[model samples]
Target: MKRISLCLLLTSFVITPFVQASNTESASLDHAQVTYVQATQSQNGSWCFNTQVHHNDQGWKHYADAWQVLDLQGNVLGERKLLHPHDNEQPFTRSLCNVQIKPDLQKVVIRAKCNDHGWGDKTVTVNLLSETGKGFKVTRNNK
Candidate 1:
């Protein structure tokens, strides 16, 4: 019983992330060269960034989502989100998109919003997988 319980815990933390990563877009912050990245902490203990979305699928109906935060060395300071990622501003999503982050985080939340034609501003949250990035490319494509 002990072994079975341990296995379940490990599997939830280890194996589940891989499956989720496939559904959520992701990128590598580590690259041969440092890329466009920025990270700042909010007074409320959240992370804010202005970066490109990776694997951005193209098309009018096709929507893409990615949020990236790379350090000076192209390492992700924390988790990344991939599209119209956040909005601390008033004109934009109006605080609809935000992030809760911590140092050496055990987990992170990903949020996204969009104005597709008439429908938009959808928000969702997912736990951070055991993976992180350092640097990445800003090309537009869906994976």
Candidate 2:
């Protein structure tokens, strides 16, 4: 009886491992300043684009009218309007644009200018947001 009980106990313990569910790791990143996250891949699969911009400034009129888009190669793809009306006092602004994340891409850059004549321009760099890679942990990823 002792031998039979010992075998049963061991079998029960061994079976538990296979019964437990396995967790799958998500290919994603999360953060407070991650107001936006995109894992979009282009049809050609040449690059992966992930972008995040925040309006975290205070006491300032926006000084710039355009939002420049740059690829991992630092080439200017295009530029668009800041989207918000001229505001000099919007205590904060966040995520000026969404990113088209292509596959196999490595880096992306963007630029934003505050309306305040006294304030300098903002250049944001988002790196390694590609598949199988880690993204930025944003706190003030504001531009």
Candidate 3:
């Protein structure tokens, strides 16, 4: 009986960390998040951006529903709505094309929202001048 009890206690100690780690990983994904964003300008002067959103899309009930591009002033320039849950496709990239951006605007931000959790606090910013002049540089926003 003593050996059995010790074995059980050791097993729990070995397994508890794994269980907690799994739960933490799942909880992090449960919230809608923008992992990455890439912006590019087309020949016609319009802009296109690809945003990567990570979410624990369980179903219609919980999913990353949309992402948007906004100027510094918070004016929405373009939005891409996710029609369905990306349950299997965690951290997926979606693209918005032909976005009309003013030439005078220097920067833009990207954000995503989930059906259950509202908008995520994180955002990504792109420098239009660098993207247009030299090459595109993707910047991550933790806030």
Candidate 4:
């Protein structure tokens, strides 16, 4: 009985650190971030955005749930819903197409949303006239 108790204690000591570390890591990554954004204008005049997000997805209970395109005035232009948690995929890319934007708009913002956290603070601003900026790229298919 004493030997079994000692082995159990040793196992707990080893396991405790791992569990604690995992909790800490998850806490730090609870918020999602928009890592990259690619915007393109189609020949039909609609817009498409490819967004990349990073989050520590624990499971269905906690994950990066969606991303959205917003104008400078914070009006939601379009949204892409993520159906499931990408636990194995650290940074995943998703596309939202057929988004109609105002012709006079110069810039737009892309933000990430998580199930646990409503919305993250980190956002990517996409300039319609510029080809590239910080974490975003813009392209136009005139043909």
| lDDT per residue (tens digit) for residues 25-140 in model 1 | 32321111112223334556565544432222333343433333333333444443223422332222121224544445543222332233221222222223322344311111
Residue-level lDDT tens digits of model 4 in 1-143: 99999999999999999999876754466888898999999989889999999988989999999999999999999999999999999899999999999878989999998998889877899999899999999997767
lDDT (tens digit, per residue) of candidate 3 on 1-143: 99999999999999999999976754576667777777877777788888899888998988999999999999999999999999899889999988998878889888889998788766777786663322236432222
TM-score of each: 0.27, 0.36, 0.72, 0.79
Per-residue lDDT, model 1, residue 77, is 41
| Candidate 1 vs 3: which has more lDDT | 3
- Tens-digit lDDT track for model 2 on 37-121? 3334334433333444344333224333345557857677544554453335332233333444444555665554434432123
Candidate 3, residue 82: the lDDT equals 95
Which structure is stronger by lDDT: 2 or 3? 3
In candidate 4, how many Å is residue 129 off?
0.6
Looking at candidate 2, the ten consecutive residues that score lowest on lDDT are 23-32
How many clashing residue pairs appear in each of the predictions shown?
13, 17, 0, 0
Model number with the top lDDT: 4
Evaluate model 2: give its TM-score: 0.36
Best by TM-score: 4
- Of candidates 4 and 2, the better by TM-score: 4
